[model samples]
Target: MQVWLDSLLALLSLPQYGLTTLFVVAFVSATLLPMGSEPALFGLLKLNPEMFWPAVLVATAGNTLGGALSWWMGYGAHKMADKYAHSSHHLRALAWLERMGPKACLLSWLPLVGDPLCAVAGWLRLSFWPCVLYMAIGKFGRYVVMTVALLYIWPDS
Candidate 1:
């Protein structure tokens, strides 16, 4: 069992696949999809201990770009809101988004609602630079803290 686990871990640890997987996972996770990027970071770190910072940065970039994409989608979907007005959830979502403003983008690192939050920000035509800044901050902080915490608890990680 130990050997099998180690082998599996070793495979996931490789720099190429691990890093690519991190970007892919982080990107998808930042899109309204119920996904996570932490496991990818942990997996890569476990394999290539020296790649800690690189992995974090890569994940952040990928996630940030994904958030940007969601923002564009929202910007484009503005006209479609009326088409889906029958859905109470969509109405509430738009209303809540209107109430929060761009600052709500600070929580863009969160799951489920985070991606959609970014889209709404764009749809509302909030200040672009500020939203992007907040998104990057939130996303980067998340990766940094999670990675550091995981490594601290498990040095071998």
Candidate 2:
């Protein structure tokens, strides 16, 4: 099992598969899951410096899509909550989200709260298109800044 996993990792590290693997990692990382796509992206960039923009674009797209999926999940969860549970705290959070609107999605690039912020935006029934636009911008900035900073800090890495 370990050997198979190692082989798969090795295959994914290859230039032909690196961008796809980075996309998957970025997508998953943008969800509620506790994962980081930076290392995968950094590794790919270190291996193929020429693919910087492609990798950044791919990561941003995957991460934005993942955030949209989180938004959908939050929409469904909000519907369920509306049907059943309605605590003061929940109402307060919903109110906050409503007040903030899609502009709040600018924080979707944060480490822990980022993905959940996308969900909360949906939970508040905020405008979907605006939220997506903000998410894309924030996520794109994050990918570009983070990848470039990492490369600058450790060029050989």
On lDDT, the leading prediction is 2
Q: How do all models score by TM-score?
A: 0.79, 0.86
Q: Residue 138 CA error for candidate 1 (Å)?
A: 0.2
lDDT of 1 by residue, 61-103 (tens): 9999889888988888878766887798878877876787777
Question: Considering only N, C-alpha and C atoms within 3 Å, which residue pairs clash in candidate 1?
Answer: none
**Which ten residues in a row are the worst by lDDT in model 2?**
78-87
lDDT of each: 0.85, 0.87
| Ten contiguous residues minimizing lDDT sum, candidate 1 | 8-17
